[model samples]
Target: MGRAHVSTHQSVGGRYRLVEITRRETNSVRWYADDLRTGRPCLVTRIGLPEEPDGAAHRAPARVLRTTESVARLCPGRIATVVDALDEDGSLWTVTAWIDGTPLGEVLAEQGTLNYVRAARIALELLDVLDAAHAEGITHGELSPGQVFVREGGPVVVTGYGLAGSTTAPRLTAPSYAAPEQARDERAGPAADLWALGALLYTMLEGRPPFRDRGRPEATLKGVDRLPLRTPVRAGPLARVVQGLLRKDPRERLTRQVVREVLTRVLSEDSGAVAEAVPSPRLRGGPALALRCADRRWSGRTTVLGTTLAVVTVTVAVLAATQSLPGTGSAADAPAASASAPGDRGASRPPAAPAPSPSGTADLPPGYRTYRAPEGFSLALPAGWQRLDTSRGADLAYRVTFGAEGDPRTLAVTYSTGVGSDAVAVWRDDVEPRLERSGDYERIGSIRSTTYQGREAADMEWYAEAGGSRVRTFGRGFLLGGGRGFSLRWTTPDAAWEDGASREALRTFLRTFRPAAG
Candidate 1:
């Protein structure tokens, strides 16, 4: 058995001087203090202990120092470095290097809804640290916005590494983020951290946690464990990703690998400028969220701030931590002209506008509209069709698939900045090789070399089985000079391939397609 040391830090100047508080969670107060020994500003957190303290008080500080320092070594600069910890005057105090940033909770308190791209980027950073910690069997178990530092010009730094078993309290730091198992007082593992991640992500995008705080810690935990999540209207592409991670059963949550893949693709889809830092939260942003964590929580009057400024200003648009503009378009400003929200997948169609042909005349097809995408491309799509899924590849290549729900016909637009000059050889060599590997792929005819809108292009048609349905695909690849190219693949049930609607839609797409520059 290990002996635990319990002592009081007689401060106010003996070793450190309390400057000001930065955050307040359940039974905890985070202070910005000055270290008397080194004359350096640092952060000091105060957590209240039970009326009668015991051996646990001694273990809490030791665990915090040991766990934090150990994980900090593994992740290097990504985690907050704890300096000292002690128990004094019936409370626990943990000191750490001064972070020149604001807590994530504070940021949300001021900024209202953050940019979708920025949220994704932050989530990616958090996942990176959690991935490292989880690999070593270390569960943060106590992750919350309050434990995250959003510093300027640096990676997101995580705190509260060893707080899980440190206390027998639920929501000691953040109740809204507690996993179901944690709420139920059941043993939690890595999946619990993932669930908390989803809650944080949801909070950043929706301006509140998925489960509303109910004044008391136990009540909030009960709501979290029992209440169904309201559909988040503002998460955009990340809505599904958030829901997947928030599943009630820990066994069904998305694996770290899958979350990483989706988030990476989302990040890669943005332009090179997406590496910038997002604005931090205001220090005195209204009535801040009171200590929502701890064994016993107090109720505070919470007001939701609403700002009409949906899109970021021109300065922030060029920078990303991400802006989440449509199609991850970096160079183009988001046009207010979009009738539908960017990530909206609803089947209903907006009033149809005329299909603009390559000649710029709106006289081509009756049931089609020229959909101008923020990615700098335009094509005529059938009225009800909308962007269904987007995936990006290595070398800055991305594919956007579109179709209406309950419609078997789908069209995919792929763009790549790296391609050879010969379009025919591309389809026959690069493209055909992949198709051939698919078990059910069968070519319709020889690859045809063609000129599309005065550019060298190649067209290929093939049949493949998907979901037990035989489908015909018409693929057209065209070069836009300097190795950049776009490919359009339209697939329809084999039975409908020869119908007038299918033929007309294909013709409209090939005739009216425009590059980003166009």
Candidate 2:
């Protein structure tokens, strides 16, 4: 969680002092608290229990505490490990280690729409944890955005694993995120969690939940049971997967295996190719196309045709300004005017604006100068930074990394001839899968598709644990033409991602990068 902006001096259990309110869902609130006894930070959740007879109220806290312990033992670091659970003054309080991440609901609220590929990645991670639970006959009855926390280093931690059956009330929190079975007052099993997963994916891709909260729990659940789903305009390649999981009938919904396959497919195929064919819900007066997953396979051939225009855009152009500007571009900062020319895309075009001068003597930002590579690339680099590593593929793909000896930041440039037709797909399918296999890999958000230097491009950001520190990376890959492309990757420690030095480096890299002459 980010730093608390507000504090409440209220104390619970007399030993736990509430420092901040992290989140509030229906009938519950989560807080960051200081364990006055141990002088440590912890997360505490408080839920109001309904009046119960037959000692049900007495057993609720024990059930939650026991289930959380068992599940945490089974899933390890994936789920929050409960340290304590107590019944206090008509409320159930479950406390765990203080997690350094943001709630998934907060992320969605701030970012609005996410990349379908990114959403799929998060869903896959959640599914893995859920799979472990279901195999052990444990169901995450209340799996909603607020129950998931995303750490800066890429892994997500889940909470509220054992709350499903603790209460006789159908759904205890976030009624808008409730499953159809729960809304129907049916016994929710793993299928209910699947539905909640689908609802979460929908919320992540669309700014709002599929069912609106009517300020009352019954009304929200009624909407979930009766309302027709509003078609997702930006889901792109995830339409069918979302719809399949959201089936009104539990038995008819897609199984977990099938859902996984569809989400995995979206990362590998071009979303636009299948999106144009699916019929979307008619809104107001007209119909729109729902961007559903393509049932068919991607042919080895690329789908997008290259333009005759000579403009060559680099994929890294956007990341240079990703943090500084949201959906906007910087002033004239083309990279072809200096030491290189655009590659063999079969066009003769005018030269781009000149690259930044290598002599720290130019009008460049302080502490930075251009580096003209013998391989035909040039970019402004920070002082003292040098080539750190290089690797190559059998198919003429190569990557070169640059960084200072002691600095925790690095930039990598890659060039390849066997590029796929879709830049976004290349990152989501090809590149990301490889990264996932690497140690502690976690993608931050969706792979974004945007224009770079007047050409098609894609950008992906993620995090990995390295040497006890969380490292965040941003990558951009763009095609030249005919299965040829270039990519640039930048990495920094998560804590320093927003620091001025890192921010300036990104902007300078984007502003001064000169592509190699073909």
Alpha-carbon RMSD of each model? 25.3, 18.6
Which one is best on TM-score?
Answer: 2
Deviation (Å) of 260 in candidate 2: 1.0
> For residues 1-518, could you state the per-residue lDDT of candidate 2 as single tens digits?
22211244557778788765456566666778899999999998877777877657667777877888777777777788787888877778888888877788666644555566567667877877777788778898888888998665555789997678787778888888888889888899988888898888888777667887765688989999999988866565677678767878777666776666665555555444434433333211122222222212222121112111132211111111010011100001001111222222122121343444444236668878788877667888999999987654433545678999899998877655423334554454334543664558877666666545555666666678878998776666555644345667777888887787886687677667756655
**Clash pairs for candidate 1:** 26-293, 171-294, 172-294
Instruction: Kindly report which residue stretches of model 2 are placed more than 4 angstroms away from their true locations once superposed.
Output: 1-5, 269-518
TM-score of each: 0.50, 0.53
The clash numbers for all candidates, in the given order, read: 3, 3
Off by over 4 Å in 1: 1-13, 51-54, 270-518
Candidate 2 TM-score, true structure as reference: 0.53
Error of 2 at 21 (Å): 0.7
**Could you tell me how far off, in angstroms, the CA of residue 209 lies in candidate 1 after the best superposition?**
0.9
- Model 1: per-residue lDDT, tens digit, 358-384? 544366677777788877788778889
Can you give the lDDT of residue 73 in candidate 2? 70
Q: Residue 181 of candidate 2: its Cα lDDT?
A: 84
